[model samples]
Target: MSEQSADPAADLSDDVRLPKEQPTPAFFESKTFRLISLVLYLGGISGLGMVLALYYLIFFDSGMPDIHLKFPVSIGGQPVQKVHEYQ
Candidate 1:
């Protein structure tokens, strides 16, 4: 008789090595896909903000002052030209 065991369970002993199947990831679950999505999302938001800001600057305007203001403003009855203390 051979030295091997006659039992079926003996064939699957600790000495035997097994092959494992690696799990495949879905497209949305992948790291590359998540990074790409984050880039696109941020880019879209910034682009929209820039476009809105441009539109507001080009189209909207603040109303002009109702009363005319005098130029060469004088402070405390002192003429603006005569004030040479800063010089």
Candidate 2:
């Protein structure tokens, strides 16, 4: 087996340094961000309000109208007949 080197600096090719932290973006500190955030918040609140209003209209108010439809049905070449007549 080969003998190991005692010097630690011989294993590193160059000196290492920690990376510097970057400053926050200008847009985050601008008024435009605040305006956009407010608009989004209002939009979300209005959407929720509309959903609640629709829920109230559907559940608490006079509900949807009932519909009835009649259609003649036939099988293979047979004439259509009322279902109650057979029973």
Query: Candidate 1 residues 1-87, lDDT tens each?
Result: 768878878778565444454456798999999999999999999999999999889987867653324333577976565333322
In order, the Cα lDDT scores of the candidates are 0.73, 0.71
Error of 2 at 35 (Å): 0.5
Candidate 2 lDDT tens digits, 1-87: 987679978877865644564555599777999999999999999999999999988877575533211333668966466533321
Tell me how far the alpha carbon of residue 72 in candidate 1 is from the true structure, in angstroms, after superposition.
Answer: 25
Q: Against the hidden reference, what TM-scores do the models get? A: 0.48, 0.39
Error of 2 at 70 (Å): 41
Query: Model 2, residue 80: what's the lDDT?
Result: 68
Best by TM-score: 1
